[model samples]
Target: MTSSIGVAVIGAGMAGKAHAAAFRAASTVYSPVLPEIRLVAIGDVYAPLGQEAAKRFGFERHESDWKAIAAADDIDVVSVVVANSLHREIVEGLLAAGKHVLCEKPLSDTIEDARAMADAAREAEARGTVARIGFSYLRAPGIAFMRQLIDDGRIGDVFHFSAHYWTDYGCRPDVPISWRYQGPAGSGALGDVGSHLSYIAEHLCGGVQEVSGGRFHTSITERPKPIGQVVGHSRGNVSTEMSPVTNDDYATFNAKFERCVGSIEVSRVAAGHPNSLSIEVFGSKGAARWSQTNPSQVEVMLHDELGDLAGYRTVPLGPAHPHYAGGWAMDAPGVGIGQNDLFVHQARAFLEEVAGLPEAESLPRCKSFDDGVHNMEFLAAVAESAAQGGATVQVPANAAGTTNTVGTNTQEVAR
Candidate 1:
């Protein structure tokens, strides 16, 4: 017999829609050893958005206020997909209410808030509740395959990692600005898209110890103010006056990890790339590369072969991969996986973890809020280095103002 878990989502935008879809998909596609998820409610500040999301996503109820869902006794799990500014309040509230949470990335607008969220997660763990950060990119099958290769010592003695996440959405001068453009700090392209790359790097490489150098550039210092609501990359009519784009349009940094030196770069103004996150790792024995633009394959180079024959080779996604079974068949042609599919795999992992089934123990970790805080520290260090004229900045061994932070130990993840 199957059990049912009550789930709620707090947001109605792109990420919220994805979470809702994933919850529904988790029940149908992946055979997670968890109670089936029943999407209970979807909440947004806008009643129409919340109501429409409820109808479209098959939620049993709609709420114009997120606080309602947080207090709902029926909700066993909640996905906090709201703005970064709201993460701390909502996540802490939900956790304090004893609800499991899957928070969207960039855990909070400030390191202080992120630290608090992590602490709350630890507290939740003490109570047998789970708190996960959404680093959905890690759910990609090709990336998972690459991680396995690295763990198996196929890429022995990892020494280098280079990555960049670039998008053209903010390239045009007329692009309107919003809360995403203004923040306490480190909230620009670096915190927005770069955070994903940073976490994935730490996930694949190791903990970042310091940032040797950093630089930032804001090409469009000012942007049109939107006349109305703005969604993911959506353009809106603007008022006559323009607002300053205080955040970095692009950023680059050199990082020292526990076992490797890595390069990090991110831009919202890149001309051609859209959601293009490219990462490569080099080791004493071999190297591997994966790009999000073409999410289905990984390129690898093995130096163990003769120098004349050694070169990068592409490996396409198939049934043998981590998540192929969830959406694609062994015979599916040409990478049929969709971006939304990653969230499904992510949701499945989160639910399985909540179930505590012996089988769930092997799944790739649903990154905890602790990991989110760790990555936020790295991002904070990079921003500080840039602010200090590109000088090296040591990443704090512990999150400041808080004694709580997750250890940098490598937790086992399902392949």
Candidate 2:
């Protein structure tokens, strides 16, 4: 087994907290495979929160500046959980500093930034450093299995795919504006939550070559506090007043894939639908469905006219499955894994990378920096296409070069 390594976290809010839990949980799950991991550092712009997180998450140190963590001597890995605008810089800097980085999605605020992140990853790879994207859904047990099934032809010749991720988070107008409402807010739903659909599109269906899409941003502005104090220790609740909601509330796109045609939707304004994320794959011989809310079970639709009636069957998945967490075995189904487990499961993909011989693991189940760059390119192309009245736009040859941010400012998608 590889020796234990030091890890650092670079955000103090919700995601930072989650990664801390996952880092600690990884030890139990990765026992015989991965060596011990020491969460050596935690960083946040808010210094007190960083200190508090260090204590709560058992980090060896805390700093207000992420650069301090990046420049630290003992750091081996960094999890970039900061805001969208900060993603590119932190990821690039961390990787440049010789630390493996797991950056939260969209890679950057713009395609340009995403490309920079991807380029940084490529450079890091050449220098033997590891980097991964933060698309957490790719770690879903059922989704992973589904990918294998599709690869093995369990679903013969996929011709179509329909994926939708809907949440009710944006339905409340009273919900004050956050960073998500501004210019290219960290990938929007397209990059924020929707990248999962796009990633699976490439992973499960195929890479999209062309897209004709339309986007929606119902709340053009928000009502966050008209003014708030930025005083230290009393950061006013900027989430309390009014601000223009500039991001899209939803986005729908039609894509031309290598072997399939599909529709993708990502929305945060789907009223009454709180936190529902599902993907459906239809093939010539069979189909399968995975729901984030029902992560423990995957619905497999097999049409064997020569056998049973054509219907989708529910399959219970648990520890019996390969790559499952330790001590988890589904006796008779119904036992479900929550959002927390997905993080642990996702971390396993990294362990595989850390253990594999060089170049053995090209891509991970979670979004890779390359994947983030690719998704941003696709989104940029789609927005461009939509802005031009839904014309088909060719995807870039590489994810590292997108100079246009608003040449395609068609919609602000719910993230």
Candidate 3:
């Protein structure tokens, strides 16, 4: 049977390509498990890139603008891969056009904007639309295993957790500057990367009750231009003229979750690492840590009071795992999955929903827009705290009146 929901993908850059591939991969990925992915149209401001991406990814057509795609009669779902600053305009347009939307992380450039987008999404849901943030790590097989472990009571009464994501490429003066360097460009270490860990904490533990944080702006605020012409993906074009860099290069936040206390560190100038992200959760019964550097394996450590010894473990991703479907289980344990694999899995989940199955039945449980907003709000608080010299701030009291009182989460930034 033909799939019911047609997909429209906006943007054609790194993440756009990944999302499109994931939508295509979702078909073969599920096999006997999920629904088909109908590629209605791929949208990009650059027509050639859009056409090329469509031809490469099996999209039925290409459009020069998202507005055109959003108006398509066949396009039922839209994936917004535009810049953070463009999220509000594009997403609001899609929602008004009666399309479900999947947007990339941190929601928007500002907390208020994020809240508005989230409110729009929530409003759309009442009319039967779904809005999701592209926090793809939540779909990783290893991360799914952690979720399962926590559900099985294997982790037991989660006590504490910590996560960190770092990369050193931006620190190099030779690297060309992009929107990532501008605070108004919807770019920064906190929103760009910390949102990943923030979503994870909110999902696995609970809403953050509060946080104390410090965000650092680097000394090298601008750089020299390269000797080449550039294309577009910016407010104007991806120019190489020497421009200013205005976002945080490093950030650290201390927080208290509903049942756990933790810290999150995000950076684009960590020195030598590239795309390093890891999360460690310690509970009363056991503890586990997984890294994005190695997407296929999860290390676990079980408590042993009687044996008088404790050690970590190595668990392999398998078919039994959430995101690791069929052929992937055949790969060697040491082999890994790429960043796009998470999107592939995420698309598969959406396909399942489109086919009339429920989200609970899909793999890689997708995050709702509300969930995304909660994380964004916490991030805003962190940014605020960080700006105020890592001031200790309390999370807004939960609506359910469930407050967690934890005391070990004080950090002085060690300045």
Candidate 4:
């Protein structure tokens, strides 16, 4: 049923121009219409930033070689926004050239190259082809309506989770080094933004079965060698030639989640936090909070019988939440949403699962490459619990079940 597909994007930098403007705004967002996507090609080993992100994302062509969009047989979908040590050789050569990939999180830069790119995305998903892991902040509609109010119990048995993902773009030490200050010790800022706060604290509480105090520091221990490339979080011209950051401009940890208990924090030298991700959950009856510096509201508190008039209220997100109705264009409540509309709802749920659709017409699929090798084995058990000083490690069970999609279908909410 591939009537038309072809998309492409291999790092035109800055989240590769938000996955090339989210595949040119994924079939103009939502509804059962995908297939003719074809913006096709923007690859970049820097050919003028892949010809200025293929003339600013309309993408008809520009490929200074990501193996020419992985040996183009008309690229049937690809994203892999480069460098986490080139995500296991450009996502195992674009899933052995069968395409359908998303990639761009801490899925590599080691955990043995994210378990060999999740075993080449399970042999390119047994030939039907599909790989994922952009974790576009879980396509935020206030974190998908706070994971649908903690899977419909409205945050009732969670028992505590906290988070932080601060950023100031490496708070000035002349922000330069690049390859994000050269990886390896929980690959800086805890594998860059604590790998989205360890998959949004295990996508709202579940499977992080252990980790502990784990800390890492770095605080600009050396950075100043750009003079060229260095795109996203741009400082772009440095060369007093310093380079010796080797990882962690602050990271914190503590998790154990088969049923909740987490705390995670991250920083890129956070001084005034130019990009903050905050979360809070604590249930038995209620508590919720969200914050990508307020990406369309969620604050909640609910513990019935408000005697002295309760607390934490905010809610705002409209079209009955969870990806806001028709996925927004003024889909109601307060009319504002950002982070590039969560990469256009993660490129319309990876082009509705590469256009095979029917998972009740898709929106919640995109998280697996065995959940990016279980988020690089929970960031290698928080860099092996900060190299043994903070102790308590455990984390490696990964039977690949953090539930990206199973039941309670979503993606049809225009009411």
Candidate 5:
């Protein structure tokens, strides 16, 4: 027998809609032992945006006040997908209301806010409520398969990793200085896409222990005020006046992990690269590479293979890989897997745990609030290193003074 779980998404932006669609699709793809998700409310600062999103995403109600989602008795799970600065308060409110929360990443704008949210989430966990941070890229078929290979020792002791996440959205001079470019929102490319790269690196390799060297670049000094509202990656026209860009446009850093050395390069203004995240991991016995640009396949090389034929081979992802089986047949060639499909996979994991199904205990999890704080700590170290002219900086062992570890069990290097 299945039940119904009331769901509310507070935000009407690109990520918020993705969360909404995921709630609608998770049941169809995974069929977890949970109630059908009822998308009960859509909330945004703008009533029209909320109303339109509710109508488009099949939510039963819409409101400008995000507080309504927490106050509503019908909502059991809430997705807080607002800007980085909004996460702490919104997540705290929903958690206080006893609602299971799935918040967007980077946790909060500042370490203090992130620590508070992590503490609140810990309190919520003690009461058996779920608190998950969205790292939707983890659900990608290729990435998940890569994780399985690493766990199966196919890659053998990972020693080095290199990752790049680039987008061209900030390249244009006429681009408006929205919240993404403001000081209160945090670092530009480093906090925006760099957070995702840091999470992915830690997700694939292990917790980053220190940033040995870091550098930041700001290509455009200033941007015009937006003439109208702008969604992510969308160009906003200038209004003649310009404001100084307060964030880094690009960043490069070398990191030391528990058992591996890694490099992370992130840019929001790289030409011709849109939403591209390419990663390569080298191990003692083998290596693997994957890219979000071509996400359906993973390329791998093994030293034990025929010497003449020892080269990277592209493997089309299928249900044979972890998490893929939930979306399609064993032989299915990455069916039901798309950019949007990732959120569905993410939501299934969250909802299955919410249902208290035994299998959820063993599944890959949505990152916890504790992990978010750890990510912020790692980012802080990189920023500190960059700010001090590429000086190395040691990262804190724990972000919130808790024993919580960053990354997944398989990704954590044995200490």
Candidate 6:
């Protein structure tokens, strides 16, 4: 009904800036044109950070309080990028105000809060508002293309999925403690990055049925207490005082899907590797592997290849890929894309759905709140298994008694 949608991003930290920049770029990508997106404001409790983000990202203004954003009539959509413990309060308030929301990942600090937020989303949906979770890595062209191939039976009956996400952000023992290091056991690296792995594993394969062989380790047992606010992974000012880390710095687990098994490893204390995530899926017919280090290509082996030529071939993403045709600036092979571009694609998708465009006219719909809840359940299962000393644990069934599958919208894939 509206010709233009007003947007605001709360929490002007690292991910918050990404959301703001994404909205600024959303309208420029893809065809069939999205409704005008107004960069209304940037909200963050830290006035300086919010003001800086607003100016840099072209927002009209900055607000120090998130409640002001919820009450503003000009804003129609908001991206909640605050701390996990703050998600329920901020999201529920925005939903009550009839604003569509795209929340950052892991849903909430706990499954209980995630479920409550989902209930709020359901109520808000009845009023024509939307709520979605941000799983930006899923927008990677190679990852999306891999899902398409599996769906089309390119790799028949996936038997094994192996994935590992490693980052050196917390490798130093001197890194100050922030919310990232403060949570229940299994919350550190597992909840931070492992959430992405769990969702991606399910997206390519199927819903996870159970998990076992869960292990968690904290290499840096304690860190200096930050004297002031810490942003993202940055270690701002810190006192000589130290605080005990209550979560794991490293976690590994095994998952059982409907028809396949998976292994996941994640760590924030990894050295040398900075933001390295790789996945290899083996199927009855062949295998495929992709890595974040090489985001623009996938290496695949298929049964169709003859004996002498049978091996993995590199497939560079191009106009022929799932989201590359009109989703990027160059829109051509080897032109390449990166992590920030994924945020652009994700932003465009969220705006399309918020515009109420038909399925045929929109990009893939963002993952629903129910899907977010299912993701939380998967994380909880892994945590439970870790607590039980690597004993097998069943993933809780969805309230709808159905597998949680992300909508690929392969119809958008160019042949």
The global C-alpha lDDT for each of the candidates, from Candidate 1 onward, is 0.80, 0.69, 0.72, 0.81, 0.80, 0.89
* Residue pairs with backbone atoms closer than 3 Å in model 3 (clashes): 209-395, 210-395
The segments of candidate 3 whose C-alpha lies over 4 angstroms from its true place after superposition are 1-3, 31-36, 184-187, 224-241, 305-310, 325-335, 397-415
Q: Estimate TM-scores for all models.
A: 0.90, 0.85, 0.85, 0.34, 0.92, 0.97
- The candidate that wins on lDDT is 6
Off by more than 4 A, model 1 = 306-309, 325-334, 359-362, 397-415
Error of 1 at 269 (Å): 1.1
- Per-residue accuracy of model 2 over 1-415 as CA lDDT, tens digit each: 4577788888877778888778777655433456677789889877878888999989998988888988888888888887788887778888889988888766778877777777778889899888987567655667767776677788899878898988776666655456665665324556556766776677676667888865555543564642442221122455543567666777778888776899888877778887788888889889999888788888898777456566888888865443443423332345677888767655655655654523222223344576677878778876776577778888864343321110111110100
Q: Candidate 4's residue-wise lDDT over 1-415, tens digit each?
A: 6799988888887888887887788777666478688887888887987898898778888988788788889888888887888778888988898888888887878777788788889989999998988678877778768777888897688888888888988889987887888877988888878888887787777777889889898877888888878788888679787978887888898888877787888888788988988898888888888898878888988888386978888988887777677875568898888898788778888788888877566777777877777787888888888899889989876667754443224545632
Assess candidate 2 and give its lDDT. Answer: 0.69
Cand. 6 Cα-lDDT: 0.89
lDDT of 3 by residue, 314-403 (tens): 887765555554534344455677777778767766656556564344454356665666666777788678778889877664332321
Clashes of each: 2, 15, 2, 1, 1, 0
- Candidate 6 colliding pairs: none
Name the candidate that leads on TM-score: 6
Residue 415 CA error for candidate 4 (Å)? 20
Score residue 353 of candidate 1 by CA lDDT. Answer: 78
Cα lDDT tens digits for candidate 5, 90-111: 9999999899999988888999
